[model samples]
Target: MSYQTTETIQRLWDDFLRESLAEVPPEQRQQFAQQFEDRFSELLQNAANGGGDGFLDLVGFGDKGPVEFENLPYPYVQPDFDDSVVPSQLHAAAELYYIYQHERMKIFKVVDVLLKLFRLGKMRIQRGPGARALYLVEKWKPLRYGVRDRMIAYRRAFNYGSSKAPAGAVTNVNFHRQLVGLIVAVAQYFRDLQVSEVIRGGPMINQRPFGSSATVQRLGIDLRYALDRSTYGNIFALTMEVGHYLNSILKLLDAPDIKKAFDANTKWNVIEVVSNRYLGGTAEPSQRAKMAESGRRILKFVADNNFETSIDPHLFQTELRPIGPHAEAWLAAYRTTPEGQRFPGVPTALRSTRNRKSIPV
Candidate 1:
């Protein structure tokens, strides 16, 4: 079945056709018009049916976007990876990196909250309660210890990487494993911190009452000052560094499934080049240059930090979880009940421990 052309496309084709056949004699113009309409109709039908796959190649057009290419010197073909590239466990690695990104954000949030308290305390200097809170924050240096302890905890989680990176050729898989280790440390660090009551209490210096607009505005200024300090500033800077590293590594380790149909030999693809440039919306040449330079810096940062020595892998192997009253009761019940009745979908077959030849409660 033939597909109908949209009014916009039909108008565009008509204009193009009129210009191309402008020199035709008046008597032959009727025939030319009929032929052009038939061909244009067929082209639209083909495009609608199968993306004009056969027609696109014949016309020397590669559809990266709305842009069109005509009468190219060579036919476009997609690029493929060289044989040197191998399949790796990238899925797991991506997940780990994401977790690291999340934890880094959490750490930032914790600091921001602590900083807010300082701002609030400073505002309440006239009040006895505010003065005492402010004094504690100044003397104790909780913010310093809070950030330091978390960073140390995270570093310890990847004990394997901390010792030394194993010497040999580094592959994509190896890079992923090392990145996983780095992020694991970060995730574990935040998870441990979250459960600590002491850190949560004065986490930002000490909790402050959420006040009206006037108080909040004053606190906001205080927040700026707190962030200006070296300790909090360093934490913020490290967060950005880690975020940039993750972004670069993920882009470098890319394994695209659906490749673009563009000629590998072609140095310049106008459509792709323009699209990438306008990715964050159209910008001036200066902004485009800045964007390019920023990308280079991120790549350099990743190159310097990727798969570096920092954490021990052994630390991630074991995790601690609290078995509170509810958990203890559930385990006791599971142990007493028949295996079949213990849980709805749990398997009856048991895996034994050293002391007992039975499934864990």
Candidate 2:
């Protein structure tokens, strides 16, 4: 039997989707979503799909560290392995880096919910090389410890690169282990809960890993993941959601200009450079070679719009719910839950610096 919290969470998730679907223009629904489905599919194939690269790469079982890239450029820069780079520009793309850095911790929390959903889907916890833990306490841990690139590895044990990094970077290889470690940690939580097991007629990993409308309602698992909760909310927050959100932002800002801007950038766009470097949207050079015509066009449109204004959720609506009794919705759904709620009794517009004052002392 599902818990009440789970049921409530699932309902909220489904309602959010239903509402979002209703708001979507009919023309944008069937055709435009094709690209999202394709991109999401690739994300699955590369990582979260049955033992895919997304999930397998982060096992961190034996030795955990970042994967060592042979052809890539500089492998090290800052201390504690802040592989995070400052973009040369500060438009939408640069904001992405800032968003990611700020929301790095929150990502872990959201990933935890996905693990639970996987369990509910009856998918076994994907085990990586060796048994290692992914945690950051006193100081910064390398990205390998809690993050994974978009692939699996037969590379170094525990480390993905050379342990001889130059004062910065992920201390050379084997970080794949760290990435894997996080996956395990997230899975372990649901395994312990016992509520993650698959129920009859429930969504299964192979057929439908992403809980369906009914499933999300029953489980109360919100799939939203926002970087800056103060700025945004649980609704429409993940990278994929960002793409959709950006589309909405453009329509609201300058719906007519969208086509014009995109037409001009048919060959290129600043967003292309930025998203490629940060948001990791659109397709890679390899994918571009094999992309279908529709896929190419969708990528082009997505790249052109960055949702510059009204990034704030309040401008839209309080998509993020309050965290509490119905919080099971959080474990199952991503951003649908309220686990990352900006503590109450504070100005919603507080900036990062001034934002600190709002946090109860």
Output the number of the TM-score-best candidate.
Answer: 2
Residues 164-198 of candidate 1: C-alpha lDDT, one tens digit per residue? 32344121223323332322333334344445434
**Alpha-carbon shift of residue 95 in model 1 (angstroms):** 26
RMSD of 2: 30.1
Candidate 2 per-residue lDDT over residues 105-218, each given as its tens digit: 233333233234334643222332100111111123222222232111101111222223223322214222322222233333334333424443533322222212222221
**TM-score for model 2?**
0.17
Any runs in candidate 2 off by more than 4 Å, and if so which?
1-174, 195-258, 263-281, 284-361
What's model 1's lDDT at 285?
Answer: 30
The TM-score of predicted model 1 comes to 0.16
- Model 1, poorest ten-residue lDDT window? 255-264
Instruction: Tell me the lDDT of candidate 2.
Output: 0.28
* Clashes found in each candidate (C-alpha, N, C closer than 3 A): 12, 46
On the 0 to 100 scale, the lDDT of residue 166 in model 1 is 32
